[model samples]
Target: MSLPPITSIHNPKIQRVRALLGRRSEREEQSAYVVEGVRLLEEAAAAHLHPQLLLYTPDLAPRAQQLVHTFQKAGVECLPLAPALFASVAGTESPQGLLAVLPLPASQLPSQPNFVVIADNLRDPGNLGTLLRTSAAAGAQALLLSPGCADAFSPKVVRSAMGAHFRLPMWAAAWDEIAAWIHQHSLSVFLADANLGQPYWQVNLRPPLALVIGSEAEGPGPQSAALATGYLSIPMPGGVESLNAAVAAGILLFEVARQRAAA
Candidate 1:
């Protein structure tokens, strides 16, 4: 039998989850983050990343209850929370009746990574999340976030990423660290820009490369530019100035995939 449900919103575990959901620092401090609903946890399980703790409501559906039982069987602490208390802590307007605290995935770049995505000062959670999703789909070996970028494990990002966090190797690094990694790997760094440099489709993306995507507002940072072996541009004949960061990333990343496939 499972332990009794927690009734207080101020319960220590509940408070911790709230802090993790609300603040990046709290997550960094604990080396953990919260994921809402059943889907994320399912992805986490698929990635072999298990949650440390799970909180759910008494009225949870049977399918979701089964999910809770799976975690319970795995030795994860499963706690029940009163509906009102769960509502108080849930990040979504309509609580999914399931929340889990999962450790931050400690993923490292594979040896001889031929493809990586570098996000330069991207602050929008949705954009960053989409980039993570696209990178995983496009077969990038890792993702590097530059300074001033939004926290990769932030709740909004985790939700928007649709479980990419469970699978992608992502790290937030200083520019110097990013540069050193590029050199160590001998990767050809290509910064994506709206204007300047060779058109992206024309470039031979089959080589071992790191693609740098910049913030939509300020473009690439000086440090980012300093690290670039070259720049890439997507041709916009419609006379548009630029594209959404995620859209640009999707287009560029798929192009990389296409080139490698045809090669």
Candidate 2:
């Protein structure tokens, strides 16, 4: 089935896609987010997610064209846009000529979750995304983002995460909610602190544990800190005061993975 090309910027679908990509609130209200690039579109399909809308341009790569056809066969609404118009809303400097509007996955806690990561007030989207990727790689069952963290579904986050969003169960909630969930699940919580804490390797990172990583500027807030069963620190033998939030999280999460694997 052939669809009309959308050349006008004022087209409702174009406007909505732009809004979703630009604003977190809009994404929340619409229950949708935008994914771009051939790799992400392929990832979305591999994850068994159907896009509510798929947009492409004449310049779309052959691989992307085939994916578009696949979506079309699956009864997805696929449309074409003029290349210039498509680039206008694209997040990357070099547009890929393909994008999709996908429903936000439910933010439920994973069933039988064993390892989890809690991010507290992380403002950097790249950092948060990398953390998600690391957590997924380390076999974390879920992630919790405290208030003030960057929107997990933002374009930069989704891009940096490299499809972790589709695989990882994640939720954003307030401190009270996070604390409640932690206690209810009976999961031990460890806060990553640069100043004072047991070395990460020395800490037991068995299943049913949650690691809390804080913002770059400030460590975990007082409320979050108070909820911790213990604290962990990475040794800085090179005289470095601290590691980047994402790097620290990767190290801690993998340490947990290493222990679990050995056991």
Which portions of model 2 show Cα errors greater than 4 Å? none
For model 1, residues 78-190, the per-residue Cα lDDT tens digits are 89998999998999888789989998877687789899999999999999999999999999999999999999998889988998887789978889998998999899999
- The ten-residue window of minimal lDDT in model 1 covers 1-10
Q: How far is 196's C-alpha from truth in model 1 (Å)? A: 0.8
lDDT of 2: 0.90
Error of 1 at 95 (Å): 2.0
Report clashes for each candidate as comma-separated counts. 0, 0
The residue-by-residue lDDT of candidate 2 on 84-198, one tens digit each, is: 8998978888988999999999987866667999999999999999999999998888999999999999999999999999999999988898898888888898999998788
TM-score of 2: 0.97
